[model samples]
Target chain A: MISPDHFQALFDPRGIVVAGASTHPGKFGFVALHNILSCGYRGEVFATNRERAEVLGRPTVADLTEIPHGKADLVFVCTPATSNPEVLRQAASVGIKAAFIASAGYGESGEAGLELQLQLVEIANELNMVIVGPNGQGLVSTPSSLCAQIVAPYPPAGSIGIASQSGNFVSSFMNLSRQSGVGISRAISVGNAAQVGILDMLEYFADDPKTSVGLVYAEGISDGREFANRLEKVCQRMPVVILKGGASGLGARAAASHTGSLATDDRVFEGLCRQVGATRASSVAEAFDIAAAFSTLPAPRGPRLAVVTTVGGWGVLAADAISSTSLELVHLPADLRDTLDGLLPPRWSRNNPIDLAGGETKDTVPAVLDAVVGHEEIDATLVLGMGIQSNQGRLEREGPFYPDHGLERIVAFHDRQDSRYADVALAASIAADKPVLIASELAIGDPNNAAVAAVRATGHYCFASAERAVIAMHRLYERTVWLESFGEPNNERH
Target chain B: MSRTLSESDSKDLLAKYGIPFLPEVLISQADHVEDALVGMTGPYAVKLCGPNISHKSERGLVRLDINGVDAVRQACHELFDEARPEDGATGVLVAPMATGLREFIAGVSVDPVFGPTIVFGVGGVLAEAIADVTVRLAPLRRYDAMDMLGSLRSRSLLETFRGEPAVDLEALADLLCSLSDAAVGIDGLESIDVNPVMIVNGLPVALDALVEFSDVEVEP
Candidate 1:
């Protein structure tokens, strides 16, 4: 296992030196160097190579021996595997605690390469240093002035922390996080995991005050016992979302040869995850998606959910998803049903779905939202809006509800009159503090794009299709219910 | 990691788990092989039982069908000569000869995926050559073992094949269930193989058995 300090150094470097940094677009070193500078990192940056007198017009050294020792905190060994061991040795000799070998070669090749990779491990152990990878793109730190040569740049620093085995997947996740308005505290691509393992990163983030959620992308783990034990401890502190590959046989074999991971007898690992509070994701997308949701949404009060929608079709779809999952739709009492029946016209469906019909304005939508959320049994609310289709529709329909069409205007009016009604629906949810996901049936405007843009802009929970919203709601409900039964108090990191 | 259990050890282990084993005994010397044979009925069998001798038939360490003393004596000498001290063979097992119209093999092995698993197959070298076996998680129920037995391609042998009475499947299931239970109960145990268990007149009998365990854990 890697110490918390070592793992933190990779993501929170006080000073950085890219050994092979350059400004040339074609060279990997140059691309990495330019990305770090462009991300606006305020730290000492140095690029070195034997051939170049300077890199990206910054002072470059021929080698580590040329640079004044002890000044560089973390060294990015942006060279081939054959050249990395020597760099690690030189860095270690000069008291550099961490090195990110952003080069490719060794173990990932074949037997001969594996043998060479083992030698690198021996040198790292002897030096008491941690090596990220001989085949990694590198790592990123959102809270610090650090860019350890990770392939992609992410959003401004926030709480979610991600550690992954595939650099490409990490880069893709960063792209998604950026587009969705989700922020990340740090992300590390532990390629091949030849030196540092998953538990190392888990431990680091478990104690990290900035990180509220942790996501791990792994093909398989090396030490099952160690992995389970450490994760059990860490999960008690914060949520650790795991996205495991090798769910199939051929993929399992590939994972083993790729990273020397044990891929058999998955039940032991499964049992461990169930015993601990950690959540398991079926794919890479769910890992980050759920992490982002958990980061923004408050914990749900109960699995009981109510869907308030202007579109009857989407309301039915959301109800179906909610039912299929752990959350149950609370049956309205006779008096509450009578209350809802009097508010909407006879054409409206008066079930738990609470549809407000097509001609209803945004004011009428929130009125129905109040009745549904007001149900004492309701734990969370899924308010469905179709104005997602037209920007003009949002102005024309909801604009009347707001005096000046300002966010504060909407918030203030919501607090004064509609807030009371909406609160009755959201009371138990607010008191229990469950998240309400407000979404659109389908965009009426540019149907294809704005619907997606609307949900992404809110930075709240949204599924691509209405059916997915149900599944997410139900899954979230089931998860929240299970957590209530299993949760221990005062263990949260932030 | 691999060691053969003596007859008493084998039978005791199986019987404790409710698996039936024919009466048998292990003697240290060839002299005792004859005496042990006398206590049994007319039909008897003699085997060279040793810790190191894993493949008994391949090494010609087994001899069957001895009607009297002379045959028992000659079989013992031939078996003992085949398993000389140089072969690192242990002692010989003399027990009541188990003759059957049907034969089958059952085994339990530690699979890396599902842990202890029970495997059943058609008996003899031919079945092993074809690798005609089905495996399931261990500590098996009788129905699970029966299901595994019925799944084999050569399952017809387990029936009343060629007018021979049907092999007692109930007895086979019991044996398999018992073996699976033993495997689950015994940690650090590696493998157990019971091959060519004779089903005489539809009644099964263990002709030979082998058990092995690790002193230290081996990587799965």
Candidate 2:
């Protein structure tokens, strides 16, 4: 059990010290100091080095005790493995409560390194300090404006908190957050997690006021029952999205029975995930997309989904995608059809997809969205082909026609209309307390598409494909069912 | 070392946990076959039973659909004759042949990571070939058993098929719960394979069972 003070010191430190501060740009010491200062961390910063008097415009001390107060909340250690024990002893003496070991050559190297790792864990226990990693890439706490990692691409601040076993996957999720405009509250790589593991990070995220969803990437679990127990407890409070790595390895035991043969490690993990309510993603992209949905959307009330598309094919694709998931495509109720009838042209396909069939005016899409998303029978809505107008506007701007042909006004109108449609659909979803997923090929094909931009402006992702939208909706519906099974009210449907 | 128990002993241990099994009697000699068949009805399935004989059907040590006293005596004699010296043949098990439209499998296995897991799936000779099973860690809650049954790919087979009533899932869930209890409560228990749990009328009956024990010392 991690205490609140230790958790706070690790993430929201009042002051941080760089124990191995260096003048060379290539060393981790330099980069660690550079990131903390550059990321606008709202805390006091100190540095310590054996030779250098000053580094990165901060005065350095030979030892932590030389500082005025002999204290700092956290220490980012960029020194070698052999120097960590003494550094930790000094930090403990000075009242530092947490340390992020940004050094390697421990635990992943060999027998000697494993011994050193054990020694570090022993010292951490004696000191009662929360240690993040001995060979990890680093971490980012966006709420503190602290990007203390050794990597680039600090994500915008939002509701998703990520903890990964592999450092590169942490970078991968942060990159996704940058691309999709889905921000992260905190991100950490628990490399060789000797003290503070992925489970501890998840528990912190579950209690974090800034985090609304937890995203995890795990490769191996040492204690399966404890993992399941903690994961289920976290899921009860907030949705958890997990992507398990190294799943193909079968159990090595020479089984003497059929049940033994069938109980592979991966299959058992899958069962554990099902028993708990954690949404297991098949890929990194899927995990981020699901986490983005969980962070942005309200909990759907039921499995019933309504697909509203600008074109027939996308709607048909979404309907086909829904067949394999637990979500249902209900027939449009008469009142819903009548309401859409007043909004769409007479040539529209009056069905569940509510295909506009090229009959939508500037006001048609938003009005149709309002009617479909606000219907009592619809638990969720998927609006497809949202960027068609913006895509057309781009084509017109690049064509032979000039501004002399009134092209500028027409393009502006198209862009404004697409943005408005995006805004209206999102508002309707929130007003009705249901998930509204917008999908368009232009989201990926044209990065500047107005609808996608508008959706991202509000920190939500516009799924690149209708199928992806369906997958996200299916995950949301599963979360709702899981919550209902426990007789717990859904995540306050915001 | 670990060893697998004979089918009769396995059934006896599991039966104590409230797992339903077909009524059968063990006949040690050919002279005892008539008395063992007194209350039981034939056509009967008679199989050679011992601590060493784990797979009876694969070795052709079983005789099924045998009717009348003479046929039962002849079947028991043949099974006893087929038993090798190393097989440590103890007796022959005689039970009325069970018929059902659908067959299901349920059992328990101790996972290396998550110990004592319960398995439920389609059963019969094709159980391994079909490879349709769902597992839950024990001891199972009633809902976990129900979820296991509902999650099988062959779940539709549990519904009414060929005029047979839909399997009484509540009863099956209870059976699974009992199996889970046995998994958790039994000492030295390693694995259990209750194959071909025949759905008779609407209830599941364990027709064949195999239980393996771990860390048991072999007698000199």
List, residue by residue over A1-494, the lDDT tens digit for candidate 2: 45989989988988899889899888889898999999899898989999856888777989777665634799999998999999998899888999999899999998899999999999999999989898998889998998888888789888899999998999999998988898999999999998889989999999999998999999978777888889989998888999999854535642556677776677677777777889989999889889999999998888889988878998998999998787999899999998888888898998988798999886788788888889999889999888888788998988899465899998998899989989999999888888999888777788789999999897778888889989988988877877777777676442
Give me the runs in candidate 1 sitting further than 4 Å from their true place.
A68-70, A93-95, A247-272, A333-343, A389-432, A440-459, A481-494, B1-185, B189-220
Among incorrect, acceptable, medium and high, the docking class of model 1 is incorrect
Per-residue lDDT of candidate 1, residues A332-426 (tens digit): 66776787777777777767777767645445555555656666777667776543324443454455554444654544443333223333333
Predicted complex 1: DockQ: 0.04
- Leading candidate by DockQ: 2
| Candidate 1 global Cα RMSD | 11.5
